[model samples]
Target: MSTLTIIWIALPFFVGFISYLLPRFDRIFSLGVAIASTGYALWLYTQPPLKLQLLDNFGVTLLLDPLSGFFILTNGLVTAAVILYCWNSGKTAFFYMQTIILNGSVNAAFACTDFISLYVALEVISIAAFLLIAYPRTDRAIWVSLRYLFTSNVAMLFYLVGAVLVYKASHSFAFAGLRESPPEALALIFLGLLVKGGIFVSGLWLPLTHSESETPVSAMLSGAVVKAGVLPLVRCALLVPEVDPLIRGLGVGTALLGVGYAVFEKDTKRMLAFHTVSQLGFILAAPEVGGFYALTHGLVKSALFLIAGVLPSRNLKELQHQPIHTPIWIALVIASFSISGFPLLSGFGAKVLTMKSLLPWQVIGMNTAALGTAISFAKLIFLPHQKQEKQGKIQPGFWAAIALLIGGLFLANIAYYEAYSFENIIKPLATIALGWLAYFLIFRQTTVKLPRLLEQFDHLIGVMSLMLILLFWMVLA
Candidate 1:
């Protein structure tokens, strides 16, 4: 089992190097590799949890528990979807090579049992992501990708310092003695995680980055890569459950901050990007269900971003005029409903569990965010729908990606679902109805103007610096 696990972890990197050797068939080979990896991930989910020791002297090890296994399965599915979406992208061999390396890095990061291993794996992911985002090498792409890498590296700096402090206090790198670690170190670690996880103010880089990158790259960023921060964040939260209240408070603020932009934003991908921040808040609000919620969000969101890939324009003013392919429209409707907590779906089941754990104020905050999601997604779902021309055939790979997510959605609903009551049925319906009403009203009346500072790189770095100081002060106090 350990050998198979190692193979599963290394499979993508190996196949990717082979793609480099045979550049001409890189696309075909990448697709084949992605499909195989997805199957392997599912197999891994069925096996009992295990740990593998790699460097006993350095205390480096890999651990796989239910949480790690959940992310492993998620990374595989999201990666396959990305490759399938990019199958006809006409990218160079280097592009596919970087992608598979990124794939392996995410797998490694999720499997790491120690802070240093996890941090190193995450940095590798950052490097690959920077390469992918800057694939065009245009001035804007380069700048955007540079900032993305810059922010990620800065966040990791906080994590590294925290880890060193933790080691000093606990004399080990593993999670075993985390309770003995100082609140100061844990505070710094989670602060970094919050930024990487795309929560509110610290994650302000998300909108510009996710919106500006190429469609497949955007899907990868939102769908899988940004998730690198979440596993560690949730892991830390679990080991020190005393911080649950603080995490939940941030969750509420993140949800509000995310939806505030999304509700009024005009750019389609940018709006969805903010929604990503908001959805992470939903998971943070219920960290115990982090694995399930993350899986559902990853699948549903990648599909949405892929659909965004095919659109004529990400701007709603232009997009509403163009007819959506019937298939794309179907995907939009289902995904939007799934995200907004409609009945008999993954979002509804996740929300049901989430609400059970929330205080009254938190529940109210979540409902407000749900309304914003509905309002924002209305931009896509209500667009004119029509059939495709005979010559314009949607690729089976595209449908395959959507099919996998839809299936995952149903499966999540089944697994998490308890029972449905009248309020469960009516509440989501009311939210959607009210959201659409508010959308139309707001659409005619005014536009939500985001502060220009949010887009400035200097502003983002300044905000992050401010956050770091505030975090230290709070922890020390």
Candidate 2:
């Protein structure tokens, strides 16, 4: 089982190499490799000691525990969706690069249990992400990729320093062993994971990088890759007994930050990107409060990212200007509503779970997040001017997938107590209402300008994160 899992991790890279050698059939290569990898992951999950040692002394290990299985499945689903969407769109050599990198990294990430292995997997994903974003060689893509690299590298530095501090204390890289180490060492580990997990203020790189990517790439990055960071964070939160407060605080801060950026974001994709941060903040806050809440949020967010890519409108102007005659257009609206947390949708369920689990402070954190998302997506109302089209129906297969996922999300929210609660129902609705009201108050008028002070908010947050690291060092001293 372990060997199979490792092969699953390596499969994408092997296929990617082949694709590179034969770039003429990139789309076919992408789809075949993705499907095969997904199958391998599923098979690996079904058979297991649940743990496998890859390099025993080197502290490299693989795990196919329940948590890892869930993440792998999510990654597979989202990646498959993205690959399917790219079928009609012309393929570039970069598509193969992005797909291969995304698959290999995500597979390696979920399977690996050692800190060093996880770090290596994450770096693999990060480097590929930089290429995908900047592949067009356009000025915008180059600028965004550079910004992403700069911010992510800084985060990586902090993560590495924390890891070294942890190694000095624990002397082992395995998560289980690390958890058994001194409390101080465990704290350092959490700090490192927090940076990787895209915690609120420290995760500013997420919005800028993801929102700026091409639509398909944006879907893959937001829906699938960012969560590579998230899965580890979730695992860390679960393993470290004393990290609850710190993680929750980070969650609240991230949620607020995401909302703030989304509120003022002018582009549709950028707005969704900011919302990704806020939504992730909600997911992070969930497990800290206890229960299986994060899973639903993770699944729903993946779907949302894919939906955002497939939707006809690219931006606010396009949405408003484009004639909504196609069946795909309707599906897009359903998807948009679902993501924005319309009642009875999958998002509502996730939001409910979060609200039910949250303390007042946490609730406040998520409410602000929802409000920001609502405002940002509201910008979509202005989707650009295009020639009108009579509404034409879409293919059954596409609509079927959307409907099925939406329905599943609803069922998971309503039927599964481990993931849902009556308490969740009340708070999520309240948050949704508050979000809607906030959108009306702040975003209804297109002229509302965010303070210039907040324009460089990413830089400010990064500096503050640096300060936090310094403070952590001082406290340890």
Q: Which 10-residue span in candidate 1 carries the lowest summed lDDT?
A: 388-397
TM-score of 2: 0.82
Give the number of the best model, judged by lDDT.
1
Query: lDDT of model 2 at residue 346?
Result: 60
lDDT of 2 by residue, 1-477 (tens): 655666677778887888887888776777777677656645654675477776457657776765576566556656666666556556676777578777788778877777888888888877888888887799989988877666666656656665765677667677666555555454455544555556555565566677668766776777667777777766666776555555666677778877776777656677777777776777778664322334445445555555555556655545665554454445555555556666666666556556667767676566666766655654543333233454333322344445544554666455444534566555555655666676667675565545535325467445645646643654354
RMSD of each: 2.2, 4.3
Candidate 1 per-residue lDDT, tens place, 67-143, comes to 77667777778877777766675678998888888888888888887888888888899999999999999999999
- What TM-score would each prediction reach against the true structure? 0.93, 0.82
User: lDDT scores for all predictions?
Assistant: 0.80, 0.63
Among the numbered candidates, top TM-score falls to: 1
Name model 2 segments beyond 4 Å from true: 37-49, 177-195, 288-329, 342-344, 359-361, 367-434, 451-467, 470-477
Lowest summed-lDDT stretch of 10 residues in model 2?
391-400
